[model samples]
Target: MKQAAQAREVDVLVVGAGVAGLSAATAAAWSGKSVVLIEKSDTIGGTAAIANGSIWIPNNDPAIANGFTCDLESQVRFILSECWDGFDESQKWCGVSKETFLRVDRYVKSGLRVARDLTNTRVQTFTQLDKIFKRYFFSTKDSVDSVRQALGPNHSRSDDELAKAACSSWDYHWENKFNKVPYGKHIWAAFDLRLAGKFFFSGFRKHLWHIVQNMVSIRSLSSLADQIPNLFTKFWGFGSGLILVERFRKHLDRQKVPILKRHELVAVATNGDRVTSVDVQTADRQTLTWKIRDALIIASGCFSHQLTGDGVQDSYSVKSSCVAPGNDGDAIRILKNADVQVNQNPRPVLAQTVIQLAKEKNAISHEPVFYFYGDSFFLVDRHGRRVMNEKLTYHDRAQHHVGNAEQEFLFLVCDRRFKERYWGLGIAVPFDQKHMIVGNNESTLHEEIDRELRDNDCDFRLADNFSANLRETKIAFNEFARTGDDREFGRGKNAFDVLGYMKPDRDHDAPSRSMQPLAGEELYACIYGLSTFGTHGGLVCDEDSRVLNSAGDPWNNLYAVGTCAASFLNGHYPSHGMSIGTGMVFGYLAGLHATSNTKRL
Candidate 1:
C-alpha cells in the first residue's frame, strides 16, 4: 500500500546531487535561502564524480593569470563555429535555432562568473590547462619535452602544415570557418599533490600499523581494507571527478544545507504558471512532499540508465551510456507532468566509439576505443569501407555508426605493429586476448572472420564482400600512407590528429606521425559500437535558467539546469569539460534567479 505523503516547507528545493544540482544548492544556500538538496541514489555525486573533474570556463582566472585573454565575443564565436551547420550568421544558428546566439552569448558571459564564484567561495579551486597536450592527461616532464620536440617551432615542417597542426592540437573545431579565437579556456579542479601525498602516507601507515598490532588479522587484511573504502590509493589519483563533487559537498555542509540522499523526486505539482510543490519517494518507500516557498530547481541528469527503459534508446538510438545509474529521466517526467515543454536536439546523444567485450564468463564490458595507436589501424564498416576521419572527436566519430542502419557494427583493423604499439600505450584495462580475431595474413583474416560468422561465434558480424573490399581498402590505405595524404578522410591533416594522444618519438621518420604504412604481417580486428556520455536534450530553458512552457512562457518558480535542460550549445560538444561547465553555469544562474524577489504568480 502507498504511504501518505509527509509535508515539509523549504525556500528552495534542488534535485539530483550531481555537479549542477550541487552548484545550484550551493548558490541558493549562499544567498541566505533555506535550501534542501536531494539525490535519487545513496551517493551524492552523480556521473560527474566518475568523470575527469574538469570544467571549460572561458576567460577563467587561471587563463587570465597565464596572460591568455578570451573575450566574450570570441567565446561566442568559438561556440558558434563548433556548432556550425551551414547556416548564415544572421540566422544566428549555433545548430539549435536563431535564439542559440543569445544562449551562447549568455553562457560565455556567465561561465567565467560561475567559475570565479565557485573559486572565491572556496567551493572549488581550478587550475588553467595551458599546454596543448596537457589538456588530455596529466603532464609529465618526459611527455612535455617529447611534444615540444615533435611539434616545436624549430622542427622541419612547412608553415601551413605546422600552423594547421598547432590549431588542431589545441582546438577541436579549429578547422571551422567561424572560429578565430586563441585556445586557452579549459581548466581542471586543482588538486594539491603534496597534501595528497601526506594523506596517502598517513593512510598507508595506519593500515600497516593496524595489521602489525593484530597479528592474527594479517590473513584478513585485504577484506578489512576493502571495508575501509580505498584509503590506500584514493588520494594518489591526480584527476578525479569525485574531487570536484567533494569540494561542493563540503561547501554545502558548511553552509548548513540539508542534502537528502536516497530520496527520489517523484512528481511536481504546479499552479497555472508556477510550481507549487514536489513529491519525493524515500529509499524506505516513505512518500514525502516539499512545498516550494520560493522555487524548485531540477538539475536531475540524463535518461541513460539501461534497465529503466526510459525510452532514451528508442528516442536517440543510443546504447551503453557511462553516466550514473540514477539518471533515468526523472527530471523529464516531472517537467512533463508540470506541463513544461521539453525539446530535442537533432543529435541528442553525445557518444564515443567503444569496443564491447566479455570480461568474464557472463559479464559484458564496454571500453572506449578513441585513439588508434599508429597509422597502421583504421575503422571500417561491414564492407571494409573507411568509417570516418578517425581523428575526429569521439562525439563526432560515434555518429558514423548510425549513418547506415543496416551496418550494425564497425571493425578496427590493424597489423601486429599497431597492436604492439597500442598495448604499450598504458591503458588502464589491459586488452583481453579473447576479444581479438587474429590472422597470419589478409586471406587468413578473411577466412577466420568467415568462420566466426558461419558459426555465430563472434561479437562482430561483417558483410560477405568484406574479403574483397578489404584488399582494395588496404591498397588505398597504403597509398595514402606513402604519400602522407589521406585524400579519402584527411586523417593526418589536423594537429590534434598527431599530438592529441602519445607524443611522437624524436627519431620518428614517418611522413605523418598519425599515418604509417601497414608493414606487419599478422592482422587483427576488434568490434566497435556506440557509447554515450549522456542525452543532451531536455526541458527548454531561457537565459535565466527558467523552464519554459509550450506557449514560450516561463514557470515563475521552476528552473532546469544541466542535462535536464536543452544545452546552450544545442548538440555540439566543444572540447573537454563542456557538459559539466555549462551545467554549473546554468545552475548558478538558476539558483540566483530562483531566489530573487519577483512577484509570485
Candidate 2:
C-alpha cells in the first residue's frame, strides 16, 4: 500500500481513469496545462478498460475527408427524436443553430484530434478510416422506411425509434454510412451512430451522396483507386476500449502525468463556487491532498456493486458487474455531499449475464450458470416461457431481462451440443462437467436439482425435470427444434439474433440451426443468471460539461463526464459505446473549457 506523502499541484485535476477522465487528462495536458489523474481502483482504466470501446462521433472529419457529406439538419432532427415527444433544444450548446453546429472545425475536428491522440493513429486518409470503421456502419433506410409506412403517419414514431427497430431487427447491413448531416449532438449524437435511426438512415442516404460526390463514372473502383492509399497508420492497435484507454494512459505516461491508482477522491475544498483542491485517500488510508489552481474534472464512473456498494443495484440483478472492480459511486456521493442534485436511484446495466466457472479444473461449483449466443440454447423463465427477443443488442437484452418478472430465475434450456459449444464465459473449450447438474428422467431432475445447485455453490436456480412441470417448456423446445422458430419469444427473427454467426458474409437474420433436439433424446437445463452491464446516472451537467447544483447553478471549476453524469438521452441507453462516447466528447469539452482563458465552470 504505497502512498503519496506530499500535497501536489496541477492545473487540471482529473478524477477517474475511464474514457472520460483519461480523455480529459490527455486533452488538458496537451492543451498546455499541468494535470494529475487519480483513480480509486488499483487499475487506471475504470469500467472502460473491459468494455467493447467503440465510440460514435457523427459527422466527423472522416465523413468529409473523402467527399462524404452528412446531413447536419437531419442529424439534429434525429437526435431530438430520442426524447420521444419533445426535447429542450436550449440545452444544446446554448441553442446553436444547425449552421453553427456543423462547424466540425470546432466539435468534430477537435474531437477527432482527441480521438487520434487516444488511438495513436497517424492514419488520416478518409478511405482508411472508412475501411477501419466499416463494421461500425450499417445503412437502414429501406428497413426504416418500410416500417414507417407500416406504422403510418398516425404512429409518429421518430426516425430515431424507427432506426432502433432497424438496428435491432438485424435484417440489413448498413455499412457504416452515417448521415451527411452534422446536426444532432446531445441525445442523438449522444450515442454512437448505430444506436440511432437517423444516423443509419443518414448513412444510407449519405452513402449515395458520397458516391456521387466522389464523381464515379460507373460505380467503378478504378475511379476511386486514384485516391485510395496503402490504407493504415500507426495506432495502439487494440480495438476494444481496453486498448484505447491503455493507449491514452500511455500518452499520459509519456507526458509525465501522475496517474495514481488505488487513490480515491475523499473530499473537495471549494471557495464559493470554485473548487480549490481535492483530497485523495490511498490504499493504506493515507490522505494526500492535491491543490487545484485552475479546474477539477470528475470522470469517475457511475456505481457498480462489483468493488464498492455505491450505487443502487437493481432488485432483479446480482451484485457483480463486468466493469472494472472499482465502479462504486464515488463521484455520486462526493457531489451529493456537496449539495449537488445527482440523478438518484439510477438503473444498472450489465455487460452480459456472467457466471463464474470453477477457477480450478477439478474444483466444485463456484458460481452461476451463464447463457451464451451459442446455437443450441434458449432462455426460459419461472413460467417456462421466453420473455424477450433474446437476440436484441446486449443493452436492449439487459433492459428486457431487467424488466422480467422471473428475472432472477432464468434458465438456459439447451441440448448437450449447446453446452459443449459454450464452455464458459469468453471460453470456447469444454469445461469440467462436475459443475453441471446432470440427470435422466423427470424424477432425477427435480430431485437432484437443488442438491446440484448447492454443490456447485453458485447463485442460480435450476429446475429438476424438463418434462415434469414444464409442459410449455418441452413444447417450446420441440417446436424450436422442428421449425427452428422460437414461437414463444420469436427468437432468431432479426439481425441482432444472429449474433452467434462467425462469418464475414452472414445473414444476420438467419438462425443458427443449433436448436435441434439431440440425436439420443437427451435434454438439459441450467439456471441462466442475468448479469448487469454497469450503472448509469449521477450528477447532471449542462451542455458545457459543467456540473449543475440543486438550484441549477454551475459549480465553478467542477465538471463531470462518463457515467458520473446523467445521460441526456431522456434516460434511454440507446447505442453501443454511448457511455464511453458521451464521456469522451464531453471530457474533451471539459478540457477545452478548463484550458480556455474563459473558464466555463
- lDDT (10s digit) by residue, model 2, range 156-252: 5577766543332121112112322221221111222332333234333633443343333224343244223311111111234555565677777
Native-to-model Cα distance after best TM-score fit, residue 369 in candidate 1, in Å: 3.2
TM-score of each: 0.80, 0.69
Angstrom error at residue 240, model 2: 2.6
lDDT of 1 by residue, 1-601 (tens): 0111223888899998999999888887766768888898899778776565567777788767755564677668777766656545554353445445667787888888788877877788887533433433322423333234444455454544333333322455544444443346777777766544543454356445443333332234443443244233222234346777888898888877888888988888888888788888998998888788889898889765542112344444444556777776787766665677787543455443333332221112223444453467777787878868876766777777664554545677886555443431112112443455788876778777656554544445667788778878887887887787899988766655655554432233456556766766678876655656666668887788888888887888888888888775556777767788888877877888887722211
Task: Name the 10 consecutive residues with the lowest summed lDDT in model 2.
Answer: 230-239
Every model's Cα RMSD, please?
Answer: 8.4, 12.3
Q: In order, how many clashes per candidate? A: 2, 35
Off by more than 4 A, model 1: 1-7, 84-87, 91-99, 130-169, 192-237, 306-317, 344-346, 353-355, 358-366, 421-433, 447-460, 505-508, 597-601
Residue 62, candidate 1: alpha-carbon lDDT:
75
